[model samples]
Target: MPPEKKDLRNAGRGARARTPQFVKNFRGVKNWKEASTWLEWRQIEDIECITPDQAGVARGKMMPSKKFTSNTSLALPSAVFMTTITGSYPEDGNGFSYPEDDGDLKLVPDLSTLSVVPWESDPTAQVICDLVHQDGRSVEFTPRNLLRRVVAAYARRGLKPVVAPEIEFYLVRKNPDPDYPLTPPVGRSGRPIGGGQGYSIAGVNEFDELIDDIYHFSEAQGLEIDTLIHEEGAGQLEINLRHGDPVELADQVFLFKRTIREAALKHDTYATFMAKPIQGQPGSAMHIHQSIIDKKTGRNIFSTEDGSESEAFLHFIGGMQKHMPNALVMMAPYVNSYRRLTQAASAPVNTKWGYDNRTTAFRIPRSDPAARRVENRIPSSDANPYLALAGSLACGLIGLINEEKPDAPVGTTANEDRIDLPRGLLEAVERFEGDTTLRDTLGGGFVSTYAAIKKAEFETFMEVISPWEREFLLLNV
Candidate 1:
């Protein structure tokens, strides 16, 4: 017979006894402090402190486990956040140079983000943090901080932008081999998904347990997911979060990804947000819907009093078309992301705009004038939400500032339009490097640092020898 399971309710009893009085009095939670086994408990309390570097990468370290029961405060060297802005160190490499190598800076947790770890085996709680200089200034390289700056710019003009993200990802059977093709996970129905099942209710029902857990845990972590649907690819699903503040939505997207992956693992499957995890199938995307409203009037600026198209809406589209090519690095980010932007993949390859059309990079969704908005179909699900939102809002703001005029919207087949967008990661990086408008708007330091990181990642990717080379080139050449 199998051994009986231990009661988890009393697991932390012993550790609670050894915890310091001040530590037990932490205001973050009541249960955590009152629990037993403070020193020997299997439960863990961790702070999910993070800062976004120049490549739109979030990098940070967890606070020591002991710190949780010893003190309420947590801190880390500020230089930890700056090391990745440039290619000074490879993703896996340790050696890197930073201006504050002597550890003059510190990361301070923003208590507002404190939440219990809904996914950890051990009870855990975390708080997102921001990096501060030794002299107490916010770091410019921080992606979240950068986005706040753009949002403030819009606020100065009496406009507030709201965003909702539809994130698509795949559920695949876990395969240890790197070269093997991935197949769908065996669902609760005891069968693997056969092929594309776009919007099929049965496809969603197949993975009901995992999906149900995702909803439960998302709510526990305060992520307001509005809808879940089966997407175009086999075993693919999309989670749509309700539209809200840009920063809050970005945070939800970031955490939602983690929640989905964890739930998948617990249910004996793997979930991936890779832009094109499967070849010859519809690629995953993070379609962002955005609209601006007057802060005072609380009305959408994209529509007129008579529900007609407004000039602000046209200028927003114009700005997106002008800046999208340069902002490709942030939207797509990875080399694999470019693969997802191919023709016929339902992914936009050009910067054309249309009404209720999926072929264009930007589309005006059919909605009430009060709900008027632009949908950015370019960004992959693999992108960093903070940077993507920042790039997009900044571009549209430029258009609103200059009142730029957009060309006539395409009636159909935007793919046939010859409008150019960066064709690959290298081209996108070059475009980003040369563009001064995005640099000045987003920040010069961030642009240069991001360029260095992408350059390094691209060079490393080039060093890999894929199975295709050995299969075709070895015999023919």
Candidate 2:
């Protein structure tokens, strides 16, 4: 028989003990050559060469360590980039024509992202890849590559973007059937987790074992976790990552999601990143804190020499205020994602900017000159971190170029303000497609392809009837 689970109720906490600095294997591998040497040194048996799709899901080939080293060329169908979340493809539309032959795109590994698979029984390693055409042109719509393009844009102006993401998710009871709604998992207290325990020490301790595994897995892969806290919803928790390069942080988030899910399963539960997983509960958000640095001066461009707000700072906010409405589709991608944007939820309904106010989409958090930044509260947890960061940074880049002034910052809570954002996926798609500036900035091909994919997903969702409709519309409407 299995051993009894340890009692975690009221376990000593103020914050759980920090993840010990576990030395990571293959942490210094910078190329396939180095990867091969490390594999041999550590006796790694297999390697997973993967890439993040438009939905931020890992897609690619796994092979024996020898095979991975012997075969330098790896390829996957170009269609992989165009496929929707439901595994369906959209026919040619919006200037994006699906190639008749479904040509292959080569997978070029980004060696910096290489790390060990801590959960695997056999010794294994995984590295992220970038897709490129047969002619070597980068796939514009690929999530990671898209972020690279945006980062390159910043580099061209002697600027670098630093971003920190606060990712929130929920741990739910293991449910095999999709026909039923998800419920919170029972904690070490042997009772179903309850809501309104935000920031409670005991609240986070309730799932101590699972949280411990999360930290262990993250440390094994060299992923940094700045803080962890219980969120407002039952069984919901948030992880804040250390601030760093946007691309690097996006890669961490991509891998971290997989790690979280794996750790949850180890504890006989499921971890979900859905924006609005449960009804009447607060939705999860991936609030991104962002700032720009002048590469030459090695100083934050958002602040002046005297520590006052700079023109670049206001312009960045101005850009977001102007363009973020169109980019909302990328941040909140699914039909269910819109459920989290309601006024009753702890989410912003409008694009109002304010100082340290949580009710607005863009908030200027209080920090020192070096740390001064804007927190974009619009993106949901389910968003593709790569696409979300790219969208937010792209808007700020345009704002810098236009040098436009933002409206007066809202002093009071902006919760009562009008809902300026799109109400649903279809509406958001329409706004995204109509914005030529954003389209041109974030590759036209990418914008059109993304819009098409989202439209297809929305269409698929419409085919299903929710229980709410069955309950009310079946008899009354």
Candidate 3:
């Protein structure tokens, strides 16, 4: 099971703190509920602290014991307030913004419009306020922040990247089954439920009741659901989000995937974002369609009338090609993710490029003057959107900055290949590690940190023995 779903609700063996006052005040809301309230991206600062005087107002409504010693009391002052900075102060005054399609997930308007009544009136609120005050740096790590930098870079050149992401995944049986192999090995290609052929072409009604809610919920969120087609795998779906700014579209991809998972759970099913949950099945991938528009004039920079004055397009493509290997760690990021990129027909395995080629790494999806663009088919569904968009845009930026020129187009994976992308995650990370120029360009801190973090993950896998090993070797060997 992915650690994301590991129930940390009661991981530790501690009895609920039972103060008579605390119990009375709690009503029945669990501590996790309180914790969840604080999970609001920006809410990690100092909260309302109950004073001696405010006790009367709090006592007026709830319970007696609850008033003297509220359940909110369980939340420590430090726990109530999150410290975003390494030192005594917070990182920023704006507070941490958990980036998503709708910006940070604040139910209320921003602090500029927010009004804080005396927190003493409610213990629960006080805790939440403290949390909000603490996490000032959350905004820095947000997807919004990541995108903002990329968008800003484009503004300098007066170019904006039109980014549309193809989100791929499988809807599977809810919850992880222990009987299934829980080892680190992925892409085993296990069939989820019914014994059905690939892309069974089931009637719309077959999945309508299960899928309609997701589509409608997405509609309510105002997210673009451009295309929703049953993919070439059983119970798998590919959702295409409309193109927007590189960063914003990345945020939308993250949001859409999250919504799909949540909506699927409500229907007593699970949505697997694993690159390739089942072997031989079409692993999910996000093909990023990119085109640069002049920031000032709104002219498509990639457009060409007679394949002349196509310097910017060529430069952009050239940059992506040159830096792709080094920029790959940001794309494929994981060991299991590599398994998704087989010459599997559904996914692009070789790091080749061509004009409108699906089997290659990068494809010029639209060559018309009005709609000229490139589609990066390197990222897996499992990649972190922030890193993915950052790397892709970063490559484009470098390409434009250096006036890089596209070499001979590979045209196909099998043709006399010219362009080469990262072949695997480890291989890509090595390229990233070796490219000091890219590291300097992307900031040494970010590059080193990302490399180190991913290396740790790979090392963790190296330490574990898989169930497959025990199954195949335990007896036979």
Candidate 4:
């Protein structure tokens, strides 16, 4: 639990806070070596004391330019530590990153050529599952099938979900010198390439050519991207995609993340979705705009008469309210991701919702029947989109199936959830184990494997001697 407001206020009274600086000219670098040294800076190596304003700066950024109709922008940074899975530190579950790895990701043979089933099958059915395991597609229990299976369920129920994620990212330019391999890589200091234009203007017009090229590439790849826009962050930008079936949306998000990185490298700049890379600036967020459609009628399920959501929509929100704490770990699966979820400065720290309220974790936009939808505002930029979307879809299904009752919508920015999310990796694992809804919904295999994987991560973190202990507690202890 977060310290009581009084406690947090008192404890922070004498502490100095770190602030991120705004990044202007962001051109990505193809070479990781130039910034490899600083990438392992003192704080990142030893995660202790990494505030929301610090490590949150460099994970990822992706926000599309035209997802919203209003010119208004929210200035809040994402709350970092509150995510259920914010701040990832994988334990080599896949041998892809390491040779001779024993993880299951390597157990199966290459089967990309041998898909277990057509795209329309019950991705979760036992027969397809066996086929996936027989082939390499399900190797290491990759998440593709997890999402495919869920969408299949929705299809059976005469529903199809449309999901689109706001990908927010920064373009970073590097200062490289092979002679000083150990030196920190600096941002573009003095050049036309390093400055930014103001929000929604031709300011970063230098990037127009690059953005156009990206648009073409995305189209070729069958991504759902609909528009692109520059955000308030100096080098920050957003991408919006047309919504589609939830299963398709999840697959696209996975492909989209990898594609962004590859494209940025081709442009010789570093691309990141780190929630908060600079202090005193806005952080990147992955706000998911979602809607459900009746498969048979082709009408929006969340829609009400005259094009607004009815009480059924509120019940869906109720399900999110009931299970958000348990679902957070999957949404922000890394430690650094927690840095974006802090209270104050535009982040939502409470379990609340409102009409078009960007600051709330959940928001409902007023729309006509064709556009009525819900926006899940809790995912951090670094989250695994597959798992995050799955969690949300599952939650909504629960609300409708159980006809859950909901609390009154939260109306304030500062109001905090008393049941704050787990504070550490281990704590999150504990919550996962104890959550009946999640364990039951995601299945025993998923629940068990996920907990085991996360537990291994906690062990890895504990094995290290952190810089904070050396700096402030070594000799004193």
Candidate 5:
């Protein structure tokens, strides 16, 4: 017979933290009352009320569980939206601006996202929050809220968009110095991981302990893992998520990044989502598989009743082809991000799409009619999940509205040195700022604020000189 469940509220008092063998999922709780009950059961001491900032970095306050349950809301400075990834504040003017007073915005906890921090020895729970103005309006510039707005747009049309993200990342040896390059960590065999391990079962087994923890942590948090496989690069792995609502999938991706990093640290290694973490290895990508369903009909809108591809499908592709260039900045948000876009790296250089063609910017995976979808290969793993999904969906929405058709699909490789995307960060920002249609669709305030933040980051990058510059130009000039 199975053991009876304990009345944990009382049984857990002063108990040691739950071991992996007994860890339970707490994501089913839907309100503060429910969250409090779970907290009491777990004897949680701390609660992290976090929200993703512009760079998708976790930002918020952590407080005692007692204080967390007693409070109705929390506040964070509005300037968090204007801050750059380097932790520097950009000056006013140049189309970038922030609240002069830097007033506080309210943080409303997303109870659905409440989950235990599996890595913490002391029992702790973290909840994602949504920011709102003092006037009770949603903060438009925040990454989560921006994605929410795009999802709402789909709802208005009685359609729902679904996305499954295939995120690729690397495990590398701990590098304490910023100047040095990263290398693959030594695996269980006492050897450094080598490249060309694509789909190799032995490659994945190299870090069995860390991978097991990743699975355990994900299960404890109720984050579903569809598949995990070794990719082509040394120490690189790809995790595919089950398909669901766009916003929900984005939330999972947001949490999964933190989860994977925490799991890696437990083994004294680093897991990086950087698009191009190494000089010679292939870059990582967050390939998003997307499709739309009619809310009323309960059918994939991309397919017709007879099972043939519908016009909506072509328009969606058309939308991506027409506007993805302007939207590239959201996917590739950093200077290093552009380094991953080269042809030799197998990253897409143009917006040309194809049927089951890995070289194209968009690839229509072969599937049954109900499961038909397009996979966007542009977004880097380092992209803010919320912004990347919003930018992608926004483009498709515009394409559907305009009723345009995509250019001819390429049978051969599309990365023939024909560069449709911006070559660098500044150029991407310029294109983003100049696109009035996208600006209007994604909210003008968001587009301008995002453009300004990118510009600020770019300027910060210019201040630092690279090793190659000193190596080649020191005596040549």
Candidate 6:
């Protein structure tokens, strides 16, 4: 049975009380209750939080900090989360903003997300919050809430989605300078990795201490992580999470990233979830394996009594193909995400479906009929898991509703007959904006807000002077 909330809370409290005095002093907190508490929520491309202490209280409610407003510039709020001004603002700076005032929103904690900060120096606890208006309506811009809505839609149809994410990341030596290339950490062998070491047991053992800490902390926080394997890249590794409800899996993925990074920092290395952190190497991807089951019968909807592919399975893939172009912005949220989608990068660049073919965007892995699923290979490690799962499942739901038919499965190589997907962030955002079906399905407000945020980020990226530009253009052009 699952642990009760009261039991978990008591365990967290016990752990907090045992925190060392020196640790508390370093963290600048007197006790657990007095420690800084943050209400975290997912913004466009990253996570942002507000401390309740800074924002004044109101009738037993915690107000949002001043930086929560939509008009606030990213620079004013430490310039970390890549936040941007809402599109409602005019170019000439003479117009009304959507979130007219700051501190008008409230963060209602989801009690299930309550967890003690296992890696923090001080005894700190955090709860993921849902952004809502003062009157108690959910904010459309909230990614978690959006995912909840999608999950509810599936529940309404008596269908439940099971998702397992395989997240690939890199451990690199700490480099203070931004211009230098990142190198793999010296492992237990006292030597840095040089080239691909795919699925090597020795590779995983090299970082045994760090991986053990990650597993221990994840268990303490109730994250159900599964197998860990060395990936193809020099310093890349993949961690698999056991399949479960989409929302629950999303939450675990979100927290697990933080856990891994913290563990790496403690070990004097840096863990990066960037899709393609190294050039001329295999890129990291968050491949999502998804399957649907009938909530009533608990039967796999993708397979029939005789273990053959069901019509619903075909339609689900068809739906995914139709909506994948529009969903690219959420799946590959960053500008660097495109670098991972290049041809033969081991990342999919089209919506081709196949059986055990890694080259296809959607691959049907070898599994029992009862575990039939489709694996989406487009999403990068940098994607917000909540948004990625929500978009993917929503598209599948659309297909099931309309009984759409998928194209014939490609052979061993999908390189010949596949529709090319969007290759840039701009193209992706434009497709997302233009898709009316997605707008209605994922909400118009979310579509507009997401597009605005990505556009702002892209504009910022365009202004940067790169080494390539300087080296080539200084004398040649």
Predicted model with the maximum TM-score: 5
Give candidate 5 regions above 4 Å deviation: 1-25
List model 6 lDDT by residue over 1-477, tens digit each. Answer: 243212322356676576444332311223323322221111112123321110011112222332332323221121111144221221212111244334455665454565555786544444455566667787665677788888888899999999999999999999999788788889989999766789999999999999999988887666777899999898899999999988778877877888899999999999999888878878899999999999999999999999999999999999998888888988998788998988765898888899999989999999999999999998899888888888899889888988988889987777445448887989998998888877788887677766766776688778888889999999998
**Model 4: what TM-score?**
0.66
**Candidate 4: misplaced stretches above 4 Å?**
1-131, 135-141, 175-198, 306-308, 414-419, 463-477
lDDT, candidate 2, 177-284, per-residue tens: 988999998999999999998998899999999999999999988899999999999999999999999999999999999999999999999999999998878999
Candidate number with the higher TM-score (5 or 6): 5
Worst 10 residues of 2 by lDDT: 1-10
Looking at model 1, residue 303 earns an lDDT score of 98
Clashing pairs in 6: none
- Per-residue CA lDDT of candidate 1, range 1-477, in tens? 221233333437774464456333222333434322332233454545665554444466665455654544444654444443334443422222344344644666555455556887665666566767767887665678778888998999999999999999999999878879888788778887867688899999999889999988877666677888999898999999899999878877877877898999998789999899987778899999999999999999999999999999999999998988898898888888988987655898888899999999999999999999999999999888988898899889988987888888987888755647888888998898787887878887667656656767777778789889999999999
| Tens digit per residue, CA lDDT, model 3, 1-477 | 464333333334442232123222321124543333322221223333321000011111222322312333222232112211111212222222211332221111111111112212232222211111133442222233445566777787777778888887787665477446312111124323332334444522356765777776565444568877767666677788887777546545655665687777766677877777776566778788888888677778876656444788888888887887788777776777877766545566555567777777788764557678878888888776766887788888898999988777775454233335555556776788788767655655455545555554666667778778989999998
Model 3 ranges with Cα > 4 A deviation = 1-143, 178-205, 305-309, 412-424, 475-477
State model 5's lDDT. Answer: 0.90
Q: Per-residue error at 459 for model 1, in Å?
A: 0.3
**TM-score, cand. 1 vs. native:** 0.86
Query: What TM-score, computed on C-alpha atoms, does each candidate reach?
Result: 0.86, 0.94, 0.67, 0.66, 0.95, 0.82
| Model 5 weakest lDDT span, ten residues long | 14-23
- In model 1, which runs have C-alpha deviations exceeding 4 angstroms? 1-46, 51-59, 63-105
Model 6 stretches astray by more than 4 angstroms: 1-97, 416-419
Give the winner by TM-score: 3 or 5.
5
Q: Find the 10 residues in a row with the least total lDDT in model 3.
A: 51-60
Which model, 1 or 2, shows the larger TM-score?
2
Q: Give the count of colliding residue pairs in each prediction.
A: 10, 0, 21, 61, 0, 0
Identify the superior model by lDDT, candidate 2 or candidate 6: 2
Question: Global CA lDDT of candidate 1, please?
Answer: 0.77
lDDT of model number 3: 0.57
